[model samples]
Target: MLIIPAEKSLDWKNPPWMTLALMLACLVIFVFYQGKDPRLLHTAVQHYLDQGLDRLEAPIYETYLEREIRLEGEADRRTDLEAFRETVAAGERASLAVTMLMDRPFFDYLLANRDLLMNGRQRQYWTEARVPIQQNLINEISAYEAGLVPAEPSLYTLVSYQFLHGGWGHLIGNLVFLFLLGFTVEKALGPGRYLLAYLMCGVFSALIYTGFSWGSKIPLVGASGSISGLMGMYVAFFGMRRIRFFYFLGVYFNYFRAPALAILPVWIGKELYDYWAAGSTGIAYMAHAGGLVAGAGLILLLGKGWFQAREAFHEPEQEEQDRQFTHDYADAMEALARMDFTLARKRFEALWRDYPDRPVVLEHLYQLAKLRPDLAEYRQRTRELLNQYLKLQQPDNLLRTWQEYLELGEAIHPLEAEEHNRVLFAALRQDDLKVAEKAFARVRDTGHRELVREAGRLLADEFGKRRMEPKANEYRLLLKTL
Candidate 1:
């Protein structure tokens, strides 16, 4: 009986997706109005990527004015100079060819699909790319104004460049995690608030990422920071829900769930451990930490209510009953543990009557029923308990429960085939021959064979009673094959 109470209804907060869309639209409009077309920026980026891709495939040009070194001769000096110049010329040609081949295709693709890949292109990209760039660009602009900047503005980027990825694997890995974590907090917090929360967390994560490598010129690409933020929020919003994770565990597809809160320590501890080890193998542990902190902090600030919501149990009556039952059960077990059978018997006797139908209570009663068999009242109560248990238990559970009773030195009921025959009859009547076979196999008596044979005869009679002449005649032909 799983009932979701009215109290469990989701908060009617702002929708994150709608808010993200609207906010992004305004940002784009602002950029557009300021003469900075997003399409142009995307095109520029695409061109840069295309240039890299072309260089990968382009043939390197090698030219040489043959320089045969004549030891101790004037030809050595003259030949070396010509060779050096040709080598330089060839390098220059190769660079130009790669750049030219890449620039056109990348820009052309961007121009053709700017609308598709820009605003409404990939909703995830906004969080992945734009948010990090916004923070870094803002910081760069601030530093530039203060005149406290390096002499040459770097074309090789750092934090802002982490959003750009080369291939489908690059984009998909980041996006999948982003959607998984982002969607959870987004749905919980609602759209509008969720967008702001996402962006804010992204910026915070970026600052942390950059803080570690303040002057790094290499481009760091991916939406990992934003995704980390969502993970942080996940811990805050849904602390203890079990999330099943998939990972290789010695070659078997082993399954397990981690409480959301417990998973945090694992992630944070791994990052911290790796950072301390100084394993600079390209993973930005700093960014993950930053995003984690931002996500956790932001959710705590904005969604303090989310934590409280989880603590709340909607069915007060059921919660009270369960709590009381637990306390009583624990006390009785403790008495049993202390070897005070008399006290345990008294406590179990009282609790058993209250929850006579409960499996745990009935089990306790059955265990005590043997020792106190002289108490005729207790013995009668045990019999009634067994009868009630058998009625509700499934076949497998019935078999197990009955055995448990028998093991307790309780009298076993006659193993009647009628009890099992009812299930067999129902299965056969529904034309479920597989279930009939399974059910019939469980019945103890050979007398049950009559019921099975009767069902088979009834099925055959039904086949004879079919109204369709073509089907009936087809059956006759099939009977000849049989």
Candidate 2:
């Protein structure tokens, strides 16, 4: 199952540099630093393995002696104990075959030292005991040196760990989410606070993971924990706003529009379920949960008013454009109110040219077109307004605007025939004969057979009832031709 937030909760005038930089940094670290050297890692693993094995030798020997002394009382067990002792004395490193001969106590001891022995053997095999390892040791060195090991938590690893990822998929997945959620948080919190919050959440995530997986030697890496925090911030910031989301479950996919806060429980529940069902599947769900909690808590403490205040700082260019749009819109409205067609037309034209997407500009322009005596410009502006409304993809606005367009007696394009037919059908159902008649006339020659037949039938029935014989007969003949 996959769920992605569709609409950006907040819009930014300029590029979100903090979000972009974070993503780029992750990519660069993965591609350049982490992917550079395999041998160095192998060597480092070998080195640690050898060191660990040396530390375990005394414990292994002590356990062996204890087991030998215990087995000496039994004649049959004496032979096994002697054989085990010989194998150990032969300086042969622990192998699966040798470990199999061990009793419960000895086997447990062997298991305790398994990591060191296995790593040592793997390193030795890969390195062939060769001297002068290559210069590319960054990847190997970074894992333990920079990456967070839950058993050995440190201040530096808390931040550095977020940047390290296990593979390409890990890196890409985290980066994608980071960008999706981070930019919104940045837009709300401002760059400085956003960066600080991100790092703190990451640190908290690491701390949470460490608490859960205490003494675990495996290195915890990736930005998921921090991004989870951003998700939390998102929920806190725009939780009440209805946000659209695209969801997929295997072959089935659909969209849902719900309050942004609704996603929080879903995310948290999924993480909790996965964490329990799939024990330690390399994902630090706890860290994600922790980050989410931290982010949400931080936002709550800062209060909603803080976010509103931060939003006041917009890019200068966007602010200037907004100011200009307001000034021009007001001027145009004033001119229209004064019935100064020349000045009003000029201002409306400039507004439309500058802000084509502004629905209000189209509405005013359409109004201006109606007041002026220029039939050609009136028709042109009416078409433009209709087209803009269609492009907006707002169903309610489209219906309202289309009704106005029909009332104005302007032509609609063939491309809009299907939608126009729907509006016509709605108008007819509502018993608005005038609008229905106007819409039918516009779509009559568009070659929409079913729509034309339906319109002809409706128009004929209505006209026949009104005792309009000529109009009724014309519609009947039109239907027969179809």
Best by lDDT: 2
lDDT of 1 by residue, 176-287 (tens): 5655455556556666666667666666766776666564433344456666777787776656765555444455554456665666666667667776685545566777
The Cα RMSD in angstroms, rounded to one decimal, for candidate 1 relative to the true structure is: 19.1
Model 2, runs deviating above 4 Å: 9-13, 44-140, 305-309, 312-482
Per-candidate RMSD, Å: 19.1, 17.8
Collision pairs in model 2:
none
Give the worst 10-residue stretch by lDDT in candidate 1: 1-10
lDDT of 2 at 164: 88
TM-score of each: 0.35, 0.50
What is the per-residue lDDT of model 2 for residues 1-482, given as tens digits with 9 covering 90 to 100?
Answer: 77766555445556789999999998898778776545565554355346443334434555565555576442334555566567667755443222332122343444465555447764464344211221233224556567898877989999998898888888878887887777767877878888988998899988988998786656788898999988887777765778778899999999999898778778888878878776536688889888888887777777555434264433334556799889888999899889897898899888888787688887877777776423667666655765675566454555576766555644422325666676666676666777778778667757778888887898899889989999899899988888
Best by TM-score: 2
The per-model lDDT (C-alpha) reads: 0.51, 0.70
